[model samples]
Target: MNFYLDVDRTIITKEHREALELNDFLKYLFNTGEVYWLTTHCRYEDTSSVLSYIMPFLTLENYDLIKNIFPTTWNTLKTEAINFSQPFYWFDDYLLEVEKRILLENRCLEKWIKIDLDKNGNNIMRAAKSHNPNLFSSI
Candidate 1:
């Protein structure tokens, strides 16, 4: 499965301003499936902007792991970069209306995992604990 990640509230904590279990999450993602950047900070082939923005929140080991996440290119909607043919999951704090529509049309609206730290700070931890090899199938 393909795992797309966003850096903001999805991975970094809004209150603490630090990444919690970011290293472990990245390690799990890389080991289990294909990981990619699907955030505004990263577009096209260059991931320097996203890496620089997330650098302050990550440890040396976390930074190294993050660099391995593949870059994605999209013109308008982030969904454009998504490979609908394969099973995938998108982790983000927010989703645009157009993007939501795209996912809804494709019958994969449930694939978007909305991460709201304000609502529940332990959401990431819960997700980590619930990891499975056949992620989509199990769900």
Candidate 2:
């Protein structure tokens, strides 16, 4: 399975200023070798910068490896960039109407996590807990 995430308000939110908690969650996902950044900042040449800001606690080596996850969206539509053949969990604060329709049509809506920054601000942490209650116990 693959894990995709948006930056900005979804992972790094106004409610929670720090990303240590989210980084812990993503670090677990990264170990699976299927984590992806599905945000605008990913369009830049240096995609690692996106994760760097949101995952300040992550080491440079790990960040470099993440940057190597080539296929990081640069001017490509997310729907087209992602291969829906494999199961994936996507977390995004905003999804275009067309994108929502496509996911629903493909029966992939269930995999999408809508991160409403205005409400349910802690959904990311909640997702981590749902995956494993003891996952973030140390952090």
Report the number of the highest-lDDT candidate.
Answer: 1
Per-model TM-score versus the true fold: 0.85, 0.67
Model 1 lDDT-worst window of ten: 128-137
* Residue 93, candidate 2: C-alpha displacement in angstroms: 1.5
lDDT of 1 by residue, 1-139 (tens): 8999987787888753655556666777787799999988888978999999988877888788888999999888899899999988888878999899999999999888776666654456455334433453453
Candidate 2 achieves a global lDDT of: 0.63
Instruction: Single out the weakest 10-residue window by summed lDDT for candidate 2.
Output: 130-139
| Best of the candidates, TM-score | 1
Candidate 2, residue 84: the lDDT equals 84
What would the per-residue lDDT of candidate 2 be over residues 1-139, giving only the tens digit for each residue?
6777777666666644533355555666676648777888776445656766645634555455556444355464666656689877776767788888889889987666666545543556664455445533432
Per-candidate count of clashing residue pairs (backbone under 3 Å) = 0, 0
The models' CA-based lDDT, in order, is 0.79, 0.63
